[model samples]
Target chain A: MDLSTLTYIVVGATFLLYIGIAIWARAGSTGEFYVAGKGVHPVANGMATAADWMSAASFISMAGLIAFNGYGASVFLMGWTGGYVLLAMLLAPYLRKFGKFTVPEFIGERFYSKGARLVAVICLILASVTYVIGQMKGIGVAFSRFLETSYEQGLFIGMGIVFIYAVLGGMKGITYTQIAQYIVLIFAYTIPAVFISLNITGNPLPQLGLIGTMADGSGISMMDKLDMVVTDLGFKEYSTQLMGSKLNMFVYTVSLMIGTAGLPHVIIRFFTVPKVADARSSAAWALVFIAILYTTAPAVGSMARLNLMNTIQTGPVGEATANLEYAKAPQWFYNWEKTGLLKYEDKNGDGRIQYYNDKNPEMAAKAEAFGWKGNEMTKVDRDIMVLANPEIAGLPNWVIAIVVAGGLAAALSTAAGLLLAIASAVSHDVIKGMINPDISEKGELMASRLSMVGAIALAGYFGLHPPGFAAGTVAIAFGLAASSIFPVLMMGIFNKGMNRQGAIAGMIAGISVTMFYVFQEKGILFIPGTAEILQWEGYTKSWFMGISVNAFGAIGALVNFIVAIVVSKMTAPPPQHIQDLVEDIRVPKGAGAASAH
Target chain B: MDNNASKYWQANVRLVSILLVIWFVVSYGFGIILAEPLNAIKIGGVGLGFWFAQNGSIYVFLGLCFYYASQMNKLDKQFGVSED
Candidate 1:
């Protein structure tokens, strides 16, 4: 079968499989809807958590970011995975033992104040909604590229698939469907990686192939060869290039680490497991699964860059006729160009593609001697690097089709997970806990379903008409979770002295500081990440201690810890019953099954 | 009972603090702060520092999770806090 038809079949089969799982695991009660009836096995929950955690960005764009940034991109790999360590050791087991639904409920009950819960709910909704917009875009983009549909049509299809499973089954449906997604996405990701690894380094495992010798029999190492190839073309050495100063990389990694732990969707996944011990072990399993992709990412990145460089720089650098002739460019080049992600300009009218770091002052002489005008390839969307990997390596059509399925699986699984988080928080925390204290169980389920629909519609709208500052969403989302949610949760669990007043003050202060910094830098509080260039330039040198806005989250979290501690001391300690409640949650004994609000 | 609880809490906190120190050492310490010096030493065609940044820290984190799980299980049982 042709590639396009195969992609359709594979993608169709996966969507149908998700719907089938949703039907099989239809949620019947509020408890089932919110926490999958709290009966998910540890291993199964781990797989689901893995799928829910690795968004389309992880599956699609991370490798490309690494490809361009080189060693600097370590912030992502370490920061993202390190959060599991915090989750495993500090947060997951205790939260599971608390044995309730939704993060806000815990905050409210622990702090003995509804106001604290309200703050948590708003933060969760904002972070999750901002996050889901990115996922919606990923879903739309992946669908458009694979199914050959328009972006809107692809987005609607994705929304439909999520609606059937998520609205009907809730966490119950999402858990089983996510297991299927994990298997599909992991296979989709690793299969092409194995092929590419073998092609370049004669090794099937991308992890080992990354550090293995090149297959060209020069006996040179892959990293050594990559450094030589990139630098010869006037690019920085691949293995040593930093993202910015070391301080920025340090804070950026810390921000992402705590932020990952703080995310409401990830935290709630632990609530589905049967035992506190299961929560701890499940975190290990989730990381094991995530690391499979995270470790392979660097290998895929460096190897893809090598492949791209060799394809363009067909011969020795600084030599005439060294660049690939545009007329005779490979099929992969033409295929990607048709997608508009890869564009080549005939700079100097040479009818050849010269791709290098043109702005590098060091390379100007070499470019002038070779009569090169500039880097001819004006646009190479980083998103294309992973999607076009199989094509670039001349892999078979089946491998290419599976990558499309993998990208969609990543996007859809996370999208459903986030929408479910938003819906449950509103229904459980707002409607049942606050708005309608005597609301019937059936009525709340309906409310949750309605909220799910609304959340999906909102996400879809943003996806269709993404703001220009779409790139800044990640920073803001992670920053809010890190500064506001994470510190409060840790203090709540570990420090019995943490009072309602303290928790409330800390969240407000932390969230405010984070928002203030992001806004002051980006220049928009109402609609952040939409900063125009002129305003962005104005705040260029305002970073405190050379820390960029993206790296200020760790500082915000520190402020939260201090403010909460000081406020709690100034105020009364938590009441005796609240102290006993903290003590009770600290132990695993007498823990009940996961219950609804 | 309160005495046992306090001791158990102390042990748990101590374990977490120690493990976190190791976490910091591997990621921020070796991966970033000492990365320049560590890059002088390499394993199998890659710089140790860059490898730690991208690959080694992740593996270490997995190890930490499993270790903490086993240790916590022991602590729970030791403190008579294991779930039914």
Candidate 2:
């Protein structure tokens, strides 16, 4: 009946469903644990991949980021989804034909060098660990909001749920659970969007509603109205705002695209499907599923921004009733206020809430003339846009509950996927492949489970006390993956001349350069107060050639390509068998079934 | 490489090149580099550039995936390399 109770019921039900799937799909062998026994249908695998790929960032944070950032956020949408095309076309089918359990294994066998495999393992761990930290943050936030607990406690609970399914069923359980998660998250995401769209633009599809006529019969389109509303309040026009330098945006988009394709968690999902062709088709299907949310995001973002501004700035600036009185603020305002993410101070002793661009001196003068000292809403966390949307729009309690469940589903699914990637890289690639080559299948499975537990604990710790490097960490992770993993994998597949020396050198160069750039900007290993180069104040400019660290992956990747090619040419050619192995992976014939061992 | 296998691989490379060019054009070209020029042209309610960035490129990506898949399958069959 109440919001909390409804949220509890929905979130509790989803958790129970995940646990049930885990128990039912409990992996019996290494194959099942790692790749779901390679029996997953293409469509099902695609849905699973969509769930795996769309983390808390996509489900919870992306639309909120777009809401505030406007057109500049297109980098995220295009960058993230466009990578699937590269995956399907360049990597997935070939990797599927290779029939490997982990990415490192492919590198190990393809390059015919354990050292190259180890480099890949390190890169995979760094990127995946960084990614899991973001997921942990999402889980903590979603849990804190829905369960009304502290962020730390929410993180612990989220870690426990992931431990259950991931440790027990591995990829098999994660796959099925992710399918369920995809359904829950997509529905939760779209329902609020549809409602907002219809209410705002009289269009049912949010995508169309974003560009459709206003429901108020204002004759102007929704975009034009939103632009007028914000610009009228001294904010930039939503449709035309550039995020950063166009060069940075371009490079950022390229980094994210390659990073999405290179992520170990996403690439491994294709390994679960039945055939090479299935891998390609499944990537398409995954994008199709992801696109449903991606397309709706811009609509939800612009609409939510419009609604938010209207809520605070009710009319034209300088008008007597322009700002909403604190006493008359909506229930959603009070609700988010309790979380401390939304706060207001009665500056100028004003009884009303003034949400405006106080940083603009011109606007400040106008605000001063209206007896407003400064903006009262001191902190409005961008993350609250989606979570608070249903309540903001006066939707029923069930919709809010579904959103809570959806956010948790997204965080949990992606967390499980990342944990799996970490676990497999450690257990299969490190432990069995190198540490104890004679490890039994049973021993390996146990190691994988143990690694999952360890990975979850580490991720939870980072979530609780996110590093100073936490700002834009997800983009950094993407950069690392794009720079290090994607290039090597592409070279390994497409270039027969690629040898072990080249692959290893390229990975090291790419990851180290990307890390150096990122660490110089963010901090060393994201430890606070460790940045050698201050971003804005340093004598030497922080970025190189006007490129932000987040966008330097393309440069790092270029360096890798050049270094690898040069090194390979200097070194001996790969052994004849290794050349044949590359040739073997290029074709679809005689591709044996995924091994059960 | 055998003749059929080489032929199939060539065909695959050709398709990928074409699709990738389209991908580059839609996303990096219309979406970013030429966004200003393209924005001068309106679509539905948004600018053509914004539409390409936000919506059109994604649809094209989907089409490319399916097209690549089907074409590859046909090529695989022609080369007698379709997996059993």
What DockQ does each listed candidate score? 0.83, 0.80
**Model 2: CA > 4 A from native:** A533-542
lDDT of 1 by residue, A515-558 (tens): 87777767665464555432544456446777878878898898
Report the error of model 1 at residue A529, Å.
11
What docking grade applies to model 2? Answer: medium
Fraction of native Cα contacts reproduced by each candidate: 0.85, 0.67
Q: Docking category for candidate 1? A: high
RMSD of each: 1.8, 1.6
Q: Where's the lowest-lDDT run of ten residues in candidate 1 chain B?
A: B1-10
- For model 1, the DockQ equals 0.83
Q: Model 2 scores what on Cα lDDT?
A: 0.89
